[model samples]
Target: MSLEAQYLANKLAKGFVGTNQIESNSRLCMASAGTGYKLSLGADGPPGSYRDFEKADVFFVIGSNTADCHPILFLRMMDRVKAGAKLIVVDPRRTATAEKADLYLQIKPGTDLALLNGLLHLLHENGHTDPDFIAAHTEGWEAMPGFLAEYPPATVAEITGIPEAGIREAASLIGRAGEWMSLWTMGLNQSTHGTWNTNALVNLHLATGAICRSGSGPFSLTGQPNAMGGREMGYMGPGLPGQRSVLVDEERAFVEELWELPPDTLRKDGVGQGAVEMFQKMADGAIKACWIICTNPVASVANRGTVIEGLEAADFVVTQDVFAETETNTYADVVLPGAMWTETEGVLINSERNLTLASPATDPPGEALADWQIIARVACAMGYEKGFSYESAEDVFEEIKRAWNPKTGWDLRGVTYERLRAGSVQWPAAREEGPDRNPIRYVDRDGELSFPRASGRAVFYARPHIPAAEMPDDDFPFVLNTGRLQHQWHTLTKTGKVARLNKLNPGPFVELHPQDARELGIVDGDAVEVASRRGRAVLPAVVTDRVRPGCCFAPFHWNDLFGDCLSINAVTSDAVDPVSFQPELKVCAVGLAKVSSPRRPCPSPSSRLRSSTCTDH
Candidate 1:
């Protein structure tokens, strides 16, 4: 299904006369990490594997609440901790994951790059960096030290709100560890300067020579199951199949030849519009049509007013989804019922590069078809019969195998459907016969480092800290940080409907520090109006010390389906990182005020506090 989607996207680019509008939901989540990896490490995938969790001497977790968001992997890290590995967590909130950390730095929101640079400076000052490794395996290293010096501990402490001692402690822990793996997620990626944040995090590993080894590297935790799979298939506007970019001439030629198309079939002048730009263009009437698949952009996209305007302005809109009641469906000119996961078979790649074949367990309820079938049928209808003539999902997978270019080091030729049926396999499976799966990238069998860049070495970026596009001021005095809860997923598509999960997380509520709650004359369970420059949402306030005094936290799960004016994304900033074009969904400025009257009263304070724990600072 993923392959067919890419195939259709490529075909559309060929048939259409303008820039390709194809973009993935990953643009909102992991595009910054992807751009950062490619710029620094010559690739998009993480260099480390889950096995690193068990063998690492230290776990440096930042911007991720692993206990709630990635419980299974968190369990492995905790298991390693029990065997005497130190754990360090850094975030704006003192989350459930931070409770188990040897050290937790409650840094201010959107200060990750500063905090990271400060740590690197402290590491260098403490003589922890490996100069030999820097000289041998990395380029552009000479430019970093001078830039890093600007972010000394005292200055970074003022910027990040972490005590100077806390900054020194984190630096000491990371510097002293023989092997440490850094893990992060949307907290670092969902920012206006998200790409730099990722680069700074990677710089630590490079400086310490803590990467391309058994138990050390920078690993990005993915928010979705098959987001990596989608990247592999090149579903984004700037990508071709097999992780090849449209901007590269050789890569474009390889894909064109494999697809049996003429020269210059793919666009190479410049990259296409990204997710944010795609919708903005739609609203401006530059783009006339859109085909949305398996995503609820109305509730999920930041600055959703613009997204709704885009949908409303488009000449035609097609929504392919399993559920008919998604917020996006309201804007669709045509609603194509697509089979759900259990009713369709496909391959799903996870953060660790493992490919698992998902087999159907049940049939579709009505006239629903698999997503690939729907796309293929549409392609045939549009007179692209030869390119999209796939009889089964296996046929599409076989074509995807032919499209895999081994030079990208993501070789998928050996990842056949039959092999996948037997068991899950990791990629870079270049050969038909041996265990071609490599856990770590950039390192060959002889333990020699070989990056895929033209220089055959990784690049060091001297990125300085940049504040979030929108910062809190007197008018909007609180930074609104959005995230997921343990019991709910994005927009609560399926999880919200489940009885037990609903019981686990009753409804949407805002987390406010007790001091801020008191200052605003709001109490736990009191109705509070959280207003941003763009929009506003009214929810119960949970006066918890989990959040910083000047920062508020809310789960971005609730929408109109739950209740009136419940979508938190309506209040998120659409400001995008210049490099990755990913929106800063994590941090935005907002003001809070108590509501004197409420249409629907909130649940008891105890019920609301059950999901999120609180403590007095």
Candidate 2:
């Protein structure tokens, strides 16, 4: 172990915080916290079961290449496609998954809300809405029509660059389909209006009554394997394990009891900060101590410079990872060595709510320990020995399942570790029915289904077409959309270690339309400097016809590897959606300039010969 790792281990042994084991008999205990219908857990009201992905029939994928990011479960989507499911892909560039899609809507960056609202308007006008479902299950339906009235196809076409006919066609496909799903990834979440983008998609699903059933839902594909699991365990701000929010008194009491702590001793009512707020706090010095487990915020979060600044400014920072060297760990006061995915025993909840286990295929590297073990030891030191005690991951899983079980409907009374050991089992697996778990939930044999609402109906949230947080203009002429490459993962933390993977695509490059490249005198393999109000980076230009004019695409995976170049996020805005707080990394205004020479004494005869010359002319 490195000196930093030893320091963290020593601290944990001294007892700073208590670790509590979470067990579950019903795999449903692992559901994500937000964007789902609210449910009651007998004595406590936990957040509702999320159905956005699980219930989708016709899935509209905008800005996400799930095939590359979440490869394992993405096969389920491929199966659905082969079964003749309708897939709509909206991205500036045609990606691998887009090649297999039934329809690919190549839209400009930052225009998602306009395109989504246009579809909703068309759905409303075409008489495709389920009035019965709206009247029974929803509260905000009446406000939706009024809100959508402003986003006509022509107006949306002008903003999004998608033809009116395409908008109408997409609406027709979604409205006529038996069930529809809308799935998005960082493309939608990393934008200034990311939360609004998520809310807008949910609005469409609810309006059409397409949620909470088989093959119909609005799902947000998580970037990390344990992103969903983290939420379930209340690792995020303002959440408790089992979908319980921190705001509720009873919910807080339940966790307090689970931890065997007095209500007065535990923090009762502080609002949990999101990623953005957390970093902001770090930068401003309000949050002096931060322990980052598993995630690398510096490389992954938007504005790499600012994220690093925040980390450096922190009074104390702790990072737990298997790797000795990481971008985030470089700034840590102490680093704890934790097991890698293949070297740990834990559960991961995928986009489809499918629970899978990662068993220890190999022993951890030198001095490295399982994440739970480290956390449990810390908890013991913090004086929470009763809750932190755990002999195995199975013990944690068992307790989490019991917490999720109620005496009544849809409880997980039947599932056991023995069954899980047999194979990966979907949630809601009752003990009595050996392996007959509910693969496709909320649907009746007759093909009709009811939403999981008090009235058994799905309500459409009337979401208006809000403008993007940032708009392209003369100063920043191109819309810069940031995303991942085919082989690379987020921030290049682990994936960067593999030589073969790095060889496929070595460094970051700006993907541009042929016309834009020609107009800017940007040749393929030519280095170009992309700049925004926030920051800038010089990268190679990959001219292709895949992207439309007036926009450019860049990957978010490069840092330190290539000239300490600024990350695309450095130029991305921090404007967030009101609901989800997801940043708008999908859309931002930027300008590109080709780098002519390594060292230039004076301007050359060719206008393009000057590295700093503006390419607009």
TM for every model, in the order presented, reads 0.92, 0.81
Writing each residue's lDDT as its tens digit, candidate 2 over 95-138 gives 88778788888886777888888988998999998787667556
Each model's C-alpha lDDT? Answer: 0.78, 0.59
Please give the clash total of every predicted structure, in order: 0, 36
Q: Distance from true position, residue 264, model 2, in Å?
A: 4.0
In candidate 2 the C-alpha lDDT for residue 81 amounts to: 68
What is the Cα root-mean-square deviation between model 1 and the actual structure? 5.6
What is candidate 1's lDDT per residue for 545-577, written digit by digit as tens? 988988888888988667665767622112232
lDDT, model 2, position 165: 80
